[model samples]
Target: MDKSAAQNSAAFLYPPIDPFDQRMLEVGDGHTIYVEQCGNPAGIPVVVLHGGPGGGCSPAMRRYFDPAQYRVILFDQRGCGRSRPHANVDANTTWHLIRDIELIRTTLDIPRWIVFGGSWGATLALAYAQTHPDRAAYLVLRGVFMGTQTELDWFYGGGAGRFFPDLWARFVELIPEAERTDLVTAYHNRLFSGDMLAENRHARRWCNWENALASIETRSPGGESPSDYARAFARLENHYFANGCFFEQDGFLQSNAHTLADVPGTIVQGRYDMICPPKTAWDLSMVWPRGTLTLVPQAGHALSEPGISAELVRVTNTLRSEAVALGL
Candidate 1:
């Protein structure tokens, strides 16, 4: 079905619900992330990971699961959303976030749970599941991003620019000619330039570039993100991209796909996902013995897209029946 027709069809997401528990979790390094729990308190556990490394969880995120069956957990990564010291990137790394996830699990007394994430969140879910394979019962990922340099080059470099030259030109025009060669580094310098005004300006452009290409339906550039959100999202994203997502080696997830040999996973990818194209998802499915990849036509990177949301809800609903068999 076309994007509009799919959107007009029945809503795929479950009904919205408030969190049964919420708190500020201190996970060291002077950072405390916001954690919230929704759905059945005694239901099977499922942790939701938001994208952007800095993208905080939202109310819509809580609606993907069946409230009567899955105990949903969502949290704002360090330096974003309701987390303390807003926009601060100190001591934040891929490994640190993994540690925080474990801390949340242990604190809540969850033995094992489903790991659901998309975009950068997919990157974290893979890292976390690989690090603590035993703790991950099953994996549901969308808009797969492996945090590899090639993937980074595709979006920040001229790869995605090839398709959206108009938006790309606007994004590139912000930096001088010499700095254009390394857009990520150039943006990093400005985003952390200590001038809040300059930072916000560059941050909006940085976020606008990504947001413009987030969905298949977004043809024109959207309005500027709020200064606070744009600052956090751009800074944290740039920080990670500049540092190669804090990985010891390139293609870390692919090399370590063996760790997930026993863990089954489902990857829902948009066929036209410009921010995180489907190639990475295909590569991951190839390496992951039990992984399944579902390519959704007329879809892009945004989790809210009709086709993407429908597939995700279908996957989550299917998993609900198998929860008992999986020992959830």
Candidate 2:
């Protein structure tokens, strides 16, 4: 699973599809989220959640589901993507996101739909499912992340740092030695510092550090992120991580696993995802009665990874067939 080879294999993904319906939905707190739908309007409804808590949705996400079989919905979470007040972290929290998801589901008139998400998106899907298990017909999760303190510490507390010392050192170098102990908070301060220049500078470093390690096969630091995308991404991510994802305690998702027992799910994880390790996915599968885990030995965390994409698309197609058989 050379990076290039993995990418080449992704040629099998569906061609980029345009949304037939798009709109900006107001979800209170002065936050308006960008929402779009593509594929058969009458097809089985499936909402796709992008990563980063700020990654937003991309055209590629539209390609995962069979356009003829799924009515795919994609949206930008609060303060991210094309949402208004770009980079605003005010009133943004995990709970707010869960509410937003509910608002979207209700707004679209969708009773129960398949939920597809990765990384932070997976975390949100889990929370949303736990909150409204009746609304989630099924789930397709990739790069599973539970938004737990332990998972955050593993990636930011020098566990991943130990493996990617070069990039980690650079990430830490941006902060003073004293503040390095809590990099998330240190970055949070700068991301919301109000000084545009300072925020962008720290934002690029924060984003670059994650991008550099996103794919294990290709370890080269990717190109510098655009100032706008970086600022929103870094600020939102830091805002969530710094507050421990706004949860009262760690392992919140696992504690609510029973809520999802009746919901079927597919957990597709990259064996060497540097950003989100496989342990969380493993733990989820063991407890989730109807969840099946598929470990892609040749992929990393990127959704574009060939092995990961192939499995996701395959699962979606499988779900479509099952739904059809059940007359869903």
Best by lDDT: 1
lDDT of 2 by residue, 230-313 (tens): 999998898888887887778888988989888889999999999999999999998889899999997899888888888998
Off by over 4 Å in 2: 1-9, 324-327
Question: What are the clash counts of all predictions, listed in order?
Answer: 0, 0
* True-vs-predicted CA distance for residue 240, candidate 2, Å: 0.7
lDDT of 1 at 153: 92
Worst 10 residues of 2 by lDDT: 1-10
Native-vs-model 1 lDDT?
0.93
Supply the TM-score for candidate 2.
0.96
Q: What is the TM-score of each candidate against the true structure?
A: 0.97, 0.96
Worst 10 residues of 1 by lDDT: 1-10
